[model samples]
Target: MDDTAIDYAAVFQALPGMVALLTPGLVFADANTEFLKAARRTRDQVVGRYLFDVFPDNPNDPGASGMRNLAASLTRVAATGERDAMALQRYDVENPDRPGEWEERYWSPVNAPVFGPEGKVRLLVHRVEEVTELIRARGGPTGGRTRVLEAELYTRARELQELNERLRRAHAREREVALALQEAMLPACRQVGHHRVAVRYRPAVGALNVCGDWYDLVDLVGGNRIGVSVGDVVGHGLAAAGVMGQLRSALSAASRVAMGPGEALNILGRYASVVDGAESATAVTTFIDFDDHTISYSSAGHPPPVLVHPDGRTEFLDQATDPPLDACPDPIPRPQAMTDFAEGATLVLYTDGLVERRGEDIDAGLARLADSLARHREEDPESLADAVLLELLPPGGATDDTALVIVRL
Candidate 1:
């Protein structure tokens, strides 16, 4: 019991470690001078204190471990003593010397049974060392520091996953809206008066979705004449497609009530100005008449129709069209522009998406469009529309929209 007591004191005190004696409840019982300095508190302040009680919560700190059931974990280790020698705990410790800032700490906890006078285990000895600098040098969060890092990473990962999911849903919604609008706006195969009409409608080249392009054939004046029309609403996607549907309905009704294409378009423009809340300012119209003979007719502003002559020659009837619809109220109707339709002749009604280009000259593009029709003049109206549109429309899809109506007399 008294073997070299003076030497033992000299060696243990100067051992260059944070040595401490702790009760079973983890309260400080005794400590070396090094231990007092590391805890950043003197013996009077720390001797009887519990570990967590000294380190109170800091509300704004992200490194703080929230609520943990450490009591159970600590109890298990203490009872078994299986992992006591090799036990380690990591935590975020507010710098004991400096308060708010935290550093990672690793505690290599060694538990030993202290014997009483009866040779039975009466107390536990917990030796501690402040390894915050060592852990920082190794680039790790230890003790409470590790828990803090884990919490921050978990929360960040959850937020990132949620953001990705939200983006996916937004894309899906846009696709659905575009699809529904296309179905509602595009023409379906149907007849105009006695002429059995077939409609083939596709979105603009490159766009892969519906734009303001539209086509329609109306039974004019109760089967006396068939009025065919095609127009492009300015813009892209759902907004333009919506306007196309409105114009399609109005154009059909207007043509049916009036006697000729010119008068019909004039009335259409008048009504459009009233019904069109915003688009009344920008609307284009072109008309087609088929009654045994074909006449290329236009009203308001629109791309002129390409006449595929009975003699297999195609020409763009480029006389200036009247002012665009809805710009003025009840505008005067000009004489219906006429082009004689041979029995074998086909008339191509198309929106400017067939010819317009961003970098290329507009007139040359139109001429090319006319030339393309002439090349494909021998093909059936349905086949002719396809071939010409594919060639003249070029690449990158329809930046605007396109509509095509072919009338073969």
Candidate 2:
């Protein structure tokens, strides 16, 4: 009991490790400064407290009693004078100061009893280590291990970014190639009997990579008459865009000699039918011929053009004379039908991509397109046509390319 003996009191009070000398009862007898710091308590608060009273419950526990086990281990060690060890995996303990976060802790314990002159166990020396840092080090990579893992992660992230960039570039290149092919195949404005006319063509959204819709307007007869054609090739990307160009050119050449819609489409279809690459080629075309006050058109497996009378009446023209060109040799479109274009009549030609949507049936899409065109017929032909296109197709409705042209008489 003297202060000068081995200063067991001073030794226990100053040890760096979490040191606590307990009685055989597993009750706190005396603890070191380090133990108090780890416990976040002072001797006045911890002395005489049972070990199980302060031991926290396990979070990943099976509802087994860990607190009681620790007390039993303490009693067993004190009785046997043997050393023991146990691991605390992520024992949930909150920093009283920073309650927002919890800490991970691990413990290594050993309790040994000292003997007195009477030869019975006199004092139980309980030593503990706050192996928090050691456990964290074990959980994470170290030195070269950390570097190797970091290198692998960095490499994986870089590969992902590189793949993303490559995909974007590929998409852009596809669009450029499709557009360039369409532009190259398009014929310059020509006279269809005597009018200086031009054409309009638009590709669908991602279909820029493979535009399927196309149009051609010609001023035949040296600017005396006008001829127009619209078509959809059964594909996307380069193949569709290429077919559109071929048809537009074929129409330009055929219309010079034959100004009738049925004849022009027939001529083009025969040429396509005899061509090789059947698996990769098929097209539907609608041709229209317009003079001073008359209009005639023929369809070949393509959507019919819409004609709006000056009196606000609308006509949907989908009755085709033949199946899509290229299905067989010498597909003949029926005789073209003639209609009078009074002062206010306007003809609208477009591909289905302009009027169709994913979840909608063909009838609904067609009806909506007709309704939209009627609402905007009072505007200039170009404005009316553009308005109708935007309304029916909206920004994303047509996944493929679209082409539209409006003629006012």
Error of 2 at 266 (Å): 1.3
Each model's C-alpha lDDT? 0.62, 0.64
Q: Estimated TM-score per prediction?
A: 0.59, 0.57
* Candidate 1: residue 381 lDDT (0-100): 70
Q: How many clashing residue pairs are found in candidate 1?
A: 12
Off by over 4 Å in 1: 1-161, 193-208, 275-292
For candidate 1, lDDT tens digit of each residue in 242-305?
Answer: 7778877877777767766777677667766665432532333344444446463764567777
Residue runs of model 2 more than 4 Å from their true location after superposition: 1-147, 170-172, 187-202, 274-292, 318-320, 330-333, 395-397
Q: What is the lDDT of residue 237 in candidate 1?
A: 65
Best model number under TM-score: 1
Cα displacement (Å) at residue 305, model 2? 1.0
